[model samples]
Target: MEKEKIDAAQESSPGITRRGFLQTVGIGTLEIAVVGAVAPAVQAETRQRGNLVPLTLKVNGQRHELHVEPRWTLLYVLREKLELTGTKPGCDRGECGACTVLIDDRPRYSCLTLALEADGHEITTVEGLMHGEQLGPVQEAFVQEDGFQCGFCTPGQVVAAEGLLRHTANPDIGEIRTGMSGNLCRCGAYGHIFKAVQRAAILRK
Candidate 1:
């Protein structure tokens, strides 16, 4: 009986099959656990290597605290984090003014603005221009005068018009055209948009 048991143990020995032996000895489990542990270590390496920068922005008369990446632009932070998508992105190079938002009540291209740079500053977008259920005067004028064609650039134009009206509540046709020139309309609705600005200016006066 002892001799027969010895023969059976030798046949099913741990070193009999190199691959199967490692699996039977729990080496495969250890390898899988090591790999699983290292994966999260690699994922930890992807966490931000830099420090968090805190910023505060006064948007639409409300204060907001935000932590942002150094490379994130104001437009990205606003649209992505704050859910303010009213500001359109056209050129993204500050030439088209499509991403226009009011910075300190002045028309500025949010695409070029760094999230950190807007700290402690007042910012406004088309979303902020409405008071509950009432549209602002500029928006009302844009609708009444048919100021937009495709309406892609209308938000920027409207925000810019609000900025212009801050300094000159009553701008003439030439001034209105000059003020709105920074914003472009591919639909060739320049004449009507200018008229709308003028009409809004008069209404504000």
Candidate 2:
């Protein structure tokens, strides 16, 4: 009975064998090897790019200076750096005008435009269209006419309409369609949007 009890105690206590030691060492070595292999690649990538270049953007009547990566798009800088998130990224392929911003009074696709490219240019985002806490005519018309349904594309649509009005004030229905062709409304609010532009024109007059 004494010998049986001693054997049971020995079984209950976990004692590492040579096989277990070897297995532990093997796992540790594999982990070390993985780290050694991956760390250099990560370090190499970190060393590769993202060198800061001087960027000066005149945004919303304010000039801003910053150091940014060469590959950063204007949309990224506008949204991430400047915190102008009114511009939405819908398609990101420039097919959708959701990232529209007025560059020198013309609607530009910020996703396709590089930060460096937008440097030294006047950039007008949706946030700039207000007059001392009052919304611009385009924005007001959009609200009054119920131009937007989802409001995701409203910023671009409003900017595009503003730009169109600058070029063709008091435009007819066909002219409005041709002018606002760049901006796409997924909410099917094109009819209301057209009326909004017309209302904005009348307000301007």
* Every model's TM-score: 0.75, 0.77
The local distance difference test score of each candidate is 0.85, 0.89
For model 1, the local distance difference test gives: 0.85
What does candidate 1's lDDT look like per residue over 34-60, in tens digits?
Answer: 687987755654664455678887788
Per-residue CA lDDT of candidate 2, range 103-128, in tens?
99999999999999997789999999
Top model number, TM-score: 2
Runs in model 1 with CA error above 4 Å?
A: 1-49
Taking the candidates one at a time, how many backbone clashes does each contain? 0, 0
Deviation in angstroms for 8 in model 1? 74
User: Least accurate stretch of 10 residues (summed lDDT) in model 2?
Assistant: 41-50
CA shift of 120, model 2, Å: 1.5
